[model samples]
Target: MNFIESELLRIFVGEQEKLHHRPLYELLVSEALERGMAGATVFRGLLSFGLRHKVHTSKIFELAGELPMVIEIVDITEKIEEFLPVVEALLRDSGAQSLVTREAVRQWTT
Candidate 1:
């Protein structure tokens, strides 16, 4: 097995938020792909709150669009660092109240 030190980039946004009239998650994933990222994955969160501390929850049985969405991408630290400003710019351009974070990780290949 081969392993490398990596960085995990995580973006948090509301499901209803949009950029360029497109879903933010979709835009983020497309941007990552266009930047030649290792990969991007989006996860819908059940309950979440940030900044203003307003809670958002959407039960599976009910229809709701305010729930949180998380976009994750993992790659080498340099790639992730290079992508940070682009993510920030996108968020700013969208005027989205969002969160972006990064952490160290290990990626293994067999």
Candidate 2:
């Protein structure tokens, strides 16, 4: 398979975080799809932590809803860069963390 150089944007937020009463992750994915992004994925982490230094995990029964969630979007450099401002705005009121990195990726079709 052939791979193309691209940008990978990862957004870190809690499962319980919301924007205008809707789940943050869901809103982000919807926005990415609407913007015609290459692809976006949301992962539910079993265990994780952030700048708060508090461990969030799904292992504990009471901590279920507060588990960490990661949303990853990968696409061409220009597309990713253009979409970054929208993402920043989305996280502005919510205070979520985002990370971007350069990577090589390939899309496959059957």
Model 2 agreement with the true structure over 33-59: per-residue lDDT tens digits: 999999999999998777777887788
Judging by lDDT against the true structure, name the best candidate.
1
lDDT of each: 0.88, 0.81
- What TM-score, computed on C-alpha atoms, does each candidate reach? 0.91, 0.84
Q: Give candidate 1 misplaced runs (Cα > 4 Å).
A: 60-63
Indicate the TM-score of model 1: 0.91
Tens-place lDDT per residue, model 1, 1-107, is: 99999999999988889988999888988989999998899999988777777777776445368888899999999999899888998899989878888899889
**Index of the highest-TM-score prediction:** 1
**Model 1 clashing-pair count:** 0
RMSD of model 2, in Å?
2.2
